[model samples]
Target: MSESAQAADPVAYIQHHLTNWSTSQPKSIADFNVLHLDVIIFSALLGGLLIFIAKKIGENLSLDNPSKLQSVAEMVVEFVNDQIKNVFPHPDKLIGPLALTVFVWVLAMNAMDLLPVDLLPSLWTGILGLFGADPSHVYLKVVPTTNLDTTLGLALCVFVLILAYNFKSKGPMGYLKMFLFHPFGKFFIPVNIVMTTIEELAKPLSLGLRLFGNLFAGELVFLLIALLTLGAGFSFGLFIWFPMQVLLDLAWLLFHLLVITLQAFIFMVLTIVYLGMADATADDH
Candidate 1:
């Protein structure tokens, strides 16, 4: 969208904001070719930030007197450990790091929501302008979780872990038996297969869709609030609209902080639980 178009139509502005900075504009149904460059970039940067912080904390280990950062990091590690212990009886060494990474990386992605919607977009526009590109064509969405692909990708990783743990705990024959008999019995092998496949697919779908749905809705709400507040200046009843926008936006921001944290924690816990379930044996039950 051009500057004049955005200025002339708020709807167009919102549409532009919702679009991702894709490698190319999708044209046909087979255009699985679209890549959300913005989502991948932000996700990678946030993941790198988490790794860097973890490395720094490991290097500065202390017993006598820990810095505030170390104290906070310890609390996070302890919290994740506790969660794993509660949910996963046979957590491997990787589970701790995986849980921590998921929690922190997701929390970082969610934190991007707290940024002003226009701030990054405006800055990106300016940067593109410097590079002699049409600023309007440069779409950038800072929140990775808001993109379905990002959430689904994370869920798929968890799904793979679940499969691995299942195979490890239950041998190949045992794993095959799980799908063939356990849920229904040998007589209902076909039904069991169908049901088991659905169940397996549902895990990742729910994990991904739940996170994506919540964050996407939150993002949309924030965008609506931005439109409300920003559009107030041009609305007919400016006096009333402006004040209401401020109150609502502020209220929503406070409420959304809780939402962002809870969503990240929920995603992490679910991943842990799913893996735990995979690792469970009939004897344990």
Candidate 2:
């Protein structure tokens, strides 16, 4: 943590921060990704917290002058409800709640960026080391959106929901019939199948990659700011260094909160929209 200590092991320190706490190495080069334990635990915990808040909001509904919590809840609920109404018709039964929960949970997960970048991961690694593992080998990335595993896991969840809606809205035969017949007609079943497969693959891949790309960029920016702060006085002749670092970090942190919320909202809404498309009775025919 000291300047000399950091200088002595620059690459090692940076590499340690970059590594993930994973179960094991994946099978191949294509499967090289390992899980980030911090992302998984915190994201799930935030999701549960979101659900708890939603439940509490439902319990303490007041029709008069809305309290601060109620107002916030109303705004989010109304936003999701409006989107559901506009995009997915007859969606009162399920899409409303689904959209609401997805938005809240995704936002909560993204909000993990509000924590100082290395704090959680450092603490986590230390705790893991106490159980006899090597501290250097204990790697964890706290930013869920920065990790492909985190985004892909969420995208996979959306995939499952889309599949469920497909089956629910249309029987197995109806669902198959859409790809097998509707789009390109009977003569081009092969082509239609390929197109459909691409469409399906694109959903999760795009969804995950979109979130991953944005968050990863934001994280890189933060890291760059950190490096600047570290190299400030030594490189820049000890000029109003700490204050400048604080200001820069503050500005970026403020901007990143907006980025985090927007990215989460977009991911959730896109997820709902995609699933709604699958539930489209018109599209199936």
Candidate 3:
């Protein structure tokens, strides 16, 4: 948006910043066919970068004199392992690595929000403009966690893992039996089925919505703060608004560092807890 237009319509400016660079405009809120190319691209890129860093760290392991990067990587791994041990005490080889991956990947994705809101989007707009695209039509949202599809996709994977762990620990018949008679006797089978199903489904819904809501609200706050100085030119208003903008932005950035890290840790811990529940046998219950 041009300076004059952005100043004139702060709503439009915020909306433009929030819009995703998608394959096509969504028809409705429930439309699942639309592809958010920006979310997919940024998510994949972050995941690939994480894998590369991990591989390099693994290759250059030094016991006597470890690099700072290696030291930090080891600390993260050890922290995740300790968390897994607390919840998933069993010697399941998969849970440790899975928890670590989820924590690091989600942390990386959330960290993207730390970038200046207009940085990537503006850069992408300029690149597209060089290729004859209209600047006004270009849309890009860098933070993948702000996208519901991305958050839900991560939750759905955890949901699938929950089911798989249940099946592995309790056989197919045992799994069915638990759903049919859980938290109630066989006499109340219908109620038990309904309650158990809802309980299972709520796991993913809560997981996905919690992460998405927090990050989406954070993104909106950043946009609103940016709007504070939208129209402030070399006038006296610039002197007043500019300092407030910088102060607010810096304060938020500091707090959001905790938010992003906490969200990632919550996601990881909850995944471990859910899997722990799934691994419980009938006797344990």
- The best candidate by TM-score is 3
Using TM-score as the yardstick, the better of models 2 and 3 is 3
Candidate 1 steric clashes: 0
Q: List the global CA lDDT of all models.
A: 0.88, 0.75, 0.90
Q: Residue 221: error of model 1 in Å?
A: 0.6
Superposed model 3: Cα runs more than 4 Å off: 1-3, 281-285
What is candidate 1's lDDT per residue for 1-285, written digit by digit as tens?
677767567788777888889999878624678988999899989989888988898899899989899999999999999999888886489999999989999999999999988899989999889989896788889999998888998999999998998899898888899899968999999999999999999999999999999998988888887776453346668777778878987898899999999999999999988988888552385
Q: Which stretches of candidate 1 lie over 4 Å from their true place?
A: 27-31, 231-239
Q: Return the TM-score for each candidate structure.
A: 0.93, 0.83, 0.96
Q: lDDT (0-100) at residue 124 of candidate 1? A: 91
Among these predictions, the greatest lDDT belongs to: 3
Give the least accurate 10-residue stretch of model 3, judged by summed lDDT: 276-285
Residue-level lDDT of model 3, residues 1-285, one tens digit each, is 663676679898888988999888999976788999999999999999999999999899999999999999999999998998788848788988899999999999999999999899889989988998977789999999999998889999999999998888888998999889898989999999999999999999989999999999999999999988876669888898999999999999999999999999999999998989988642464
Backbone clash pairs for candidate 2 read none
Q: Local error of candidate 1 at 192, Å?
A: 0.4
